[model samples]
Target chain A: MRNIKLIIEYDGTRYFGWQKQPELRTIQEEIENAIKKITKEDVKLIGSGRTDRGVHARGQVANFHTNSRIPADKFKFALNSVLPFDISIKESTQVDESFHARYSAKGKQYRYLVYNSKTRSPLLRDYSYHVPYTLDLYKIREGAKFFIGTYDFRAFMSSKSCVEDTIRTIYNLEIIENGDLIELKVKGNGFLYNMVRIIVGTLIEVGCGKKKIQDIPKIIESKDRNEAGHTAQPQGLYLDKVFY
Target chain B: MRNIKLIIEYDGTRYFGWQKQPELRTIQEEIENAIKKITKEDVKLIGSGRTDRGVHARGQVANFHTNSRIPADKFKFALNSVLPFDISIKESTQVDESFHARYSAKGKQYRYLVYNSKTRSPLLRDYSYHVPYTLDLYKIREGAKFFIGTYDFRAFMSSKSCVEDTIRTIYNLEIIENGDLIELKVKGNGFLYNMVRIIVGTLIEVGCGKKKIQDIPKIIESKDRNEAGHTAQPQGLYLDKVFY
Candidate 1:
């Protein structure tokens, strides 16, 4: 069997999520069905991680083992032809048999978009979180710095998540402000469930004068989910890239 | 009675068009209905021009006459509270009764987006027209310059249009290339039906080696609709602004 890797991009607006459910529409099932149509095999495709409903992805990585003789590069075209317009195979390649989409991933990059304006944007409704309040950029920037470096990120994760290892190293976190759009680009070795959204929410709190910039360190030290700010909306979050 | 002016923005994906038709959902009708709900009066909303289905707008202009006691600026907030998520009244103010949305408009600016890439972009699916083939930007830029002048643009119009005067002045036609996206921004005193789309299509043909760059003047001089290229898709078109 040959191990094939695929890079995917999806709108996620119409999808339940990346994970496969019995009766729900999902990105995983759609691609798996498309793969079945092309290869006639019941392949279990492994994604780098699961994104919640309405969460988009630009470089979601996945892999599957197949016995088919189709060329590695050809899988992208073939799969894309049968997949829905909301999901697309960006690149496909044959990798070593030992390679796994989830296990072999070294790190991930995510971006969260905040539309800070007085009025709602019809064009950006599905792609950004609207914060109809003026945000202090200087405060948000200062607060974001505390999230970087190795720390127990349990406070930033969702309470529903039961992962034993909550300690994650954030490599970098950058805030880019362009007009009404505030983009948070984060790179981390691993993130707990809802970690990025929580971090974004915390930073937004600091920007809105709800939380102080100096409070981020204490929030992280608490290692309690309640100590952090609310989890931001799923629509604003995007899985940017999965590093191998 | 007060003559109120409105600057509107809409996604336009779910709207039939800007015009009101029986049993069909339109941007004009939606706003009119919202106005009726607020003032309990049937008001006719006059738009600068009609945008086709799926064609978006960043700054569309409109006006309506009303006898309601609501403040001009407060109408934006009041109507927005009852309007759908896909439509927004950006700004509203009292204007002179002599001002008309369509007749008083001096010029308009439009933008067309072409996503030049091999694979389709799911995120940009509703926003841009995807051109799979690689286009020669230099040729496109050279061909676009010919459109920046007064001319009888009959050949660039749709056959369904029955306008007597086909002459119009193009103030500027700019081609902005950024990564895999090509944006064509055009300002004109007036445009015939499908003029901007045809111009974009013709320029794209020139970029793809289908039409010659020097042949633009001849195509314009032909004054025949058949002499022009195909009309581009509505999704890629945006009514950027209406100047009075």
Candidate 2:
């Protein structure tokens, strides 16, 4: 048996999410079906993580075990020919039997894009969150600094998340401005469900002067979901990179 | 009655071009419907040009005669509230009674985006044309210079175009590279049907060594459609600006 690792990219606008659902279109289902067509094997494809509906990904990782003898590098070309235009296999390679896509990940990077303008932009409607109000970058930066380092991000997680331990280490977090677009880049060992979106919502509140910069520490210490800001919309979020 | 001018932006992926067609979803039809909803008047919307299906626009110009008492500047917000998310009115103002969107235009700038990568990008599927081979930027620049100045560009026009006079003055043409994307910007007093797409197609041929750089002038002089390259796809074309 050969273990194959795949680097995937997808525009998740029309997809239900990364995971497969009965009689619903999904990123994983499309990829798995494509693999089935290529290898003629019913193999289980595992993703590094689950991104919510409407979330995009530039470098999502996945792996599967198959008995097909096709060359590893050629799988990318083969899969792309069969996959939908919105989902593409960027790269494919053979890995050891011990390799696991979800467990072996070292870190991941995510980017949330926001379009700050009085009027919404048609070109960026699906890719960015439109904020009509002017955002204070200084306050946003101050709020971003609070998310760095290791901490229990329970307050930032969604109530629907079933994960018991919410401890995670954030390696870096920064905000970048490009014209009218604002980008929030976060890299961490792992993320809880809806944690990144909640953090972004809280930071936006600080940027807009709705919340004080000093309130972030208290929100984190509270460990209650209600203490944090509302969860941001998923359209602006992108799973940028997955490292192993 | 007041002639209201609108600066429009739209993602043309889902529309049937700029012109109104029977039972077809079009940019003009959408705008006219939105205007009817706001003013309760059936008005004809004149667009600066007829962009082919799947061609985007960032600064497309249009005008309509209306008897509504809404302020000109406030028309933007009022119209955008009723328009679909894919189309937006960026600016609105009252123009001179004699001004017409199609006839009074002085110059127009169009941009063609090409993704020069070995693999197609999922995010740019509808926004850019994907060329797998490496394009020679220097050759593209050299070929771009031939399109400048006054020229009778009958050879660059599509056979289906009904325009009698093919003479047009190209003010400027330049090629810009940003990472994996190549932008071909062309500004001209006016353009014939499919003229920009044909020019881009010829330039790509020159960049890929399919055609020699010295053959450009001869092709232009031929004034025969068969002498020029094929028309590029409409997805990469964007009506960038209109200078009155």
Residue pairs with backbone atoms closer than 3 Å in model 1 (clashes): none
Per-residue lDDT over A1-244 for candidate 2, one digit per residue giving the tens place of the 0 to 100 score: 9999999989999999999899989999999999999999998899999988999999999999999999999999999999999999888999999999999999999999999888888999989888889899999999889999999999999999889999999999989999889999999999999999999999999989899999999999999999999888899999999989
Predicted candidate 1 versus true structure: per-residue lDDT over A56-169, tens digit per residue:
999999999999999999999999899999999989999999999999999999999999988888999999999998899999999999999999998988999889999999
Model 1's CAPRI class?
Answer: medium
Model 1's alpha-carbon lDDT is 0.94
Residue A208 lDDT in candidate 2 = 92
- CA displacement after TM-score superposition, residue A127 of candidate 2 (Å): 1.7
Across residues B1-244, which tens digit of lDDT does each residue of candidate 2 receive?
Answer: 9999999999999999999999999999999999999999999999998999999999999999999999999999999999999999989999999999999999999999999987778998999999889889999999899999999999999999889999999999989999989999999999999999999999999999999898899999999999888898899999999989
- Please identify model 2 stretches exceeding 4 Å from their true place: none
Residue B43 lDDT (model 1)? 98
Worst 10 residues of 1 chain A by lDDT: A117-126
lDDT of 2 at B117: 81
Best by TM-score: 1
* TM-score of predicted chain B versus true chain B for each candidate: 0.99, 0.99
